[model samples]
Target: MDEKLIQRLESAIARLESLSPGSKPPSGTLDAVSAASEPSIVAYDDLLVEYVVKVSLAAEKIGGQVHDITIVLSQAFATQKELLMKIKQTQKPDGGGMTEFLKPLNDKLAQANNMSEGKRSDFFNHLKAASESLSALIWIAYTGKGCGKQKLLLLTSYFPIFNINLASKQQLFALIFSGMSMPIGHVEECWQSAEFYNNKVLVEYKNKDPYHVEWAKALKELYVPGLRDYVKAHYPLGPLWSTTGAVVSAPKSAQPSAPNPPSASLANLASSSSSRPKQGQGMAAVFQEISSKPVTSGLRKVTDDMKTKNRKDRAGFVSSGENEVQKSAPKTAAKTGPPKLELVMGRKWVVENQIGVKDLLIDDCDPKQTVYIFGCKDSVLQIKGKVNNITVDKCTKMGVLFTDVVAAFETVNCSSIEVQCQGAAPTISIDNTAGCQLYLSRESLETSITTAKATEVNVMVPSSDPDADLAEHPLPQQYIHTYQDGNFVTNPVSHSGG
Candidate 1:
């Protein structure tokens, strides 16, 4: 046996001896005997130390992964800057034809997507989302016209990455201190870091970037609630430490004057160990499990209640008769269908949760107001007047037609979206989107288009000759980035004619 194990065994033996009834020790050895008798306390301390080490190792692994993600993000941004420079150069009067670039970026995005497929953890999913968002930002930067504020909005995507990283660290801390009985100084530091990140950094970011508040809200709607439930479920004993370096346990008056017998304490410890859930699992497994479950407390509860009520409501309609079911169908449809036009906060129009609506119109005058369309599927939205900004998010097979936008037209976390600008817009941004078709009018030709993590995007611009057919141009989705002479070089992928 190892020397430490032997020493522990000896100590345990002494503890058992000291705990015997009527036991007595030498005058100077009383305290030692008392300490030795509490072998379970020592065991608990050792277990905490083991967990601390495990947490450290887990932190290193997570840190490395986070670092890798940052590297990829930096590379993507660098490539975007290079592409912008190239576009600027090519647009110059004396600039020559652009060289054919390779598709290395496509390969990187493909790798990220493949890694995030079925049964992957949140870390991988975040990686995929980040990559896709980056691609969308790249597309917007390349194609959309924008000033500093737009660039800042593009940078806001990084907040999700920050949120996830901090959340992971917080979860690790929760795991280690779940059932701790004493106030640990190091653990206190961890708690303070979490509090600071939540109350200071995240709050400030959210306040500054009103356009991207969804990412911050996600931390509260998903991460925070899920973590609260997870701790409650897995560590029912709760945290026994407080921020003031005080142990949160029974008061001195309530605590027993004498500790439990050594035999009983050891028995209880063994039983608890055997009963612990996933006792043999590693820290990585724990983290993975935690990441996999994102319980949106309020949303989930509402959804569940809605489901139950719907089922109950339908039961009578279906069971009564076929005619009754037919009569109730329209009512159900009316209840679930999209709401009428509503201008929110006097500055924004909100259209959400509609499906297969072919004639959704926002015809009201709006030079100062913005528009947001969300969670709609197979829908068409027509905005008749110029708006300050427009964002289409988390929708599928959606089509948008607008007269003009004063600032930017953006699509995010969407798929198969079609946008038509009849007048003009300063910029069009696509991020974390796929299969977008942009129809640009003559007046909108000067509009800048930017995209990141997006694919299969095509732009149709009117030809100079009125009689000529509209020109179709496919945006580059892949690029090759290289370093030469102390500067990074990037080029879009090109295909030769067969």
Candidate 2:
């Protein structure tokens, strides 16, 4: 009756119209079916099986069988939609020509609505029969031959209990487009002539053989209560659950409440009075003298200090070596070398040199080399003499013997050194005790200066902590060139492994 409902009716009818003569089938039906039959379909079949399992699980959770309830529920939704469309499209004196066309449909819809629930169920059963006919028609359309009786039976067995009227493309579309304006007879005629399916194919209406007594019993159990108690007990949705809509309830039990404790002062006095002995004060005297007092802050301080020490000991940071990296330096580089750099690919790299200007070049590499470099921590190492294919691990050890080296790819092993730049200016300066001050262009340096002479004995230092004084004490010069193991025509020879 409302505009929105009317629009839905109109849309449904239009959809039905399109489905009138011939409409498109489900987009991937053929592919899905073909793929289902192939050996390779196992992979996709796994996905389908998973969904089917989930469907069964959901049905079990709701106390119903997946194949049964879905049919009735879907039917209910379709019937509701049809009733709505009919109500909206009901013709009036002022209604337009479209309304006149919708008049007969309104009467049929009213009749369908007035039918008893059992009658509706019968109608749905009829719709299901029609749907099977349609399915066979489609098979014939695709294969140009009528499906056999056994094939029809197999198809029927596989078909889940879905409401054909609710699920049908033509019916749903008609509900939307014509607003129940078209007569039911016309709708039936459209489906009859549609080439969508081959009616010549045999049809099967039952999941089980009709002659089976148990099959009839199961069918009866679906709608009846009490008579099928044994069957209902085994069914997931339980026979009684659907028919009687009854839920099991447990007997209620009263819980007792705990008695409240006496106030703190009263409890304390009572404890003192009860504990009075020959060596202690009398109970009456202790009770008379008792008075409330606040806890002192000094006691709390002692307790807090004890807790702090306990935590410190538990964490292992109380030991000197465990917290070595966090200690302050004496403003002097270790005789060994600066801390090593961990190169992690994908993360940004900051490589700069102190003392003098040096050129460093980098290039994209092949898959193997890319993996080796990118897998590195912090930043990748540069192998000496190898353009882009060498491993830094094979070129050099963590030592700074050269001083004049400008640039060379060399392998070095060292740990990282952390310094805090305490409230100092952002710019950093590299200075040497040997009377030479190096101005680095950037905060960090990354290079393999193997060919040029070593400039400094310092390299492999981490960025200063946000509060450290890196500007005051400059980094030492690191070995820029490699101490070649032997004379070779080429600087870098490929090594199989690091």
Candidate 3:
């Protein structure tokens, strides 16, 4: 809504176009990169292969079962039926064309799977699990997750649900087992557990509705720390994995480019008439482009004016080797304006051997001390102490985490942000700002808990998601009373606030 934000976003859109507008298909395109026509002219960037390697290495850690993941991922490419069909048609007299293209991935996954059980350390297993999880997430991105878009519509044109759902076991297995994720049976079963669902619901309580809150909670639990963590760690910033799942469920395409013969204001009315077309166009562009570059539209909107006049953009982009020019912004910014941001509670971290909360109360409002929390949709709880690390077990009804150290209240940062999951419906919950910041290496959980009795305080009140899981915990009656009266106080700390 702010004019300044609009200008900044426009600048960002220009930048994206100049940097990576994506490979536009020839008007009735054919074999633009096929070797049959030109054997010696392989593009040979190895970028696509390199991306596959990163995804494979990350997933194979779990069990080296990637075939299932790939099969699910193939679903995302369903709309590219022409592309898929072409690859299939080009098969060398045998059924090994696409399969052969995926050979390296299969071998990598097999190697990850073949490691002796005893020899596979906990770290190794964690890495593998992370990779497999990422593969699934990537698959979801390809198909827009569950939302119907151009490719989804094209593929499921006759399906009643208006889209192909990956909730089924067979489809899930196909995606993961093919040197990608594990299997739908395994991943979905994880969602079916009562305890897992309860814990997941607790975390996702901040936003969303009740209808499928339980299912959504389970999905988030399976994704965060479990699958998303590995993918984020291994892939490049602008790699395909990040955007794959989010793009699948994208809104419909831009209404076939508005029929091309509209008057000025009529065109505006037509485009704004529905969100589906706009979202579809946006999602399509995002999915196609993420393969080569990072999506920073939500990260920051730096305008040409800002780059020239604003000191902050210059300081951040100039010194960091980023191209802070105005021509690289997202094209969607032209329509939607700058991203809207929401402040979130992020994980705790240590800096220079000092165990402290990222969003801590500053002595005098220092920007470095002013850490920005991304992705969280609800209020955050910041606990500080001499504590060396943190592990998020669960939250109380009051939405606070009690720890052994004297924790301090921290400042919060909010941004008007746009949520983009790269290519498909993000496999990861974009709501958990805590975990989201972890990807930046700027935040992490507080110290691990030991010799401490953790407890939660439940507050029975209207919440973001009314049907969210309710965990039982004993709370001090007096503390509850104080909080109700808006006079809550922090318990006395054993140590001074950091």
Best model number under TM-score: 1
Best candidate, lDDT: 1
**Model 3 reaches what TM-score against the true structure?**
0.20
Give stretches of model 1 more than 4 Å off: 1-340
Please state every model's RMSD to the true fold in angstroms. 26.2, 31.9, 28.6
Residue 439 shift from truth in candidate 3, angstroms: 24
lDDT of 3 at 451: 16
lDDT tens digits, residue span 1-498, model 3: 265346446545544444465745442233432311221111111222323334334333423323344333223223222232233233221112223333333334333333312222212223233223322322221222322132123222222332222232334344333433222422343333223223333332224334233333333444443333333432222122222111222224523354566556966687566423445577676556565556564387767666655655455443533464444555534633432222223323321111122243212221112122222333333433222112222111112232222211221121221211111111122211121121110021221111111122222222246576433222232322236456655553233479
Better structure of 2 and 3 per TM-score: 3
Tell me model 2's lDDT, rounded to 2 decimals. 0.29
Measured by TM-score, how close is model 2 to the native structure?
A: 0.14
In candidate 3, residue 273 scores what lDDT? 69
Candidate 1: C-alpha RMSD after superposition: 26.2
CA-lDDT, candidates in order: 0.55, 0.29, 0.30
lDDT, candidate 2, 315-402, per-residue tens:
7454567456455343333322343333335422223211111222233332122112111223322323112112122111111111
How much lDDT does candidate 1 score?
A: 0.55
Ranking by TM-score: 1, 3, 2
Estimate, for each residue in 1-498, the C-alpha lDDT of model 1 and write its tens digit: 276577678877776676678786663354444443343334433432333233333323445443355355445434533333233223311101111121334344444444434422313323443443333322222212222232232233222324343333344345344522221222233333333223322322343344223332332322233323333332333222123321222234633378776566878899777645585787876687656667663253356646755666655443677898899899977755755468877887888878889999988857778788877889899999888778887789999999988767878788999999999987788877889999999899998887767899999999889999989999999999999999879999888998
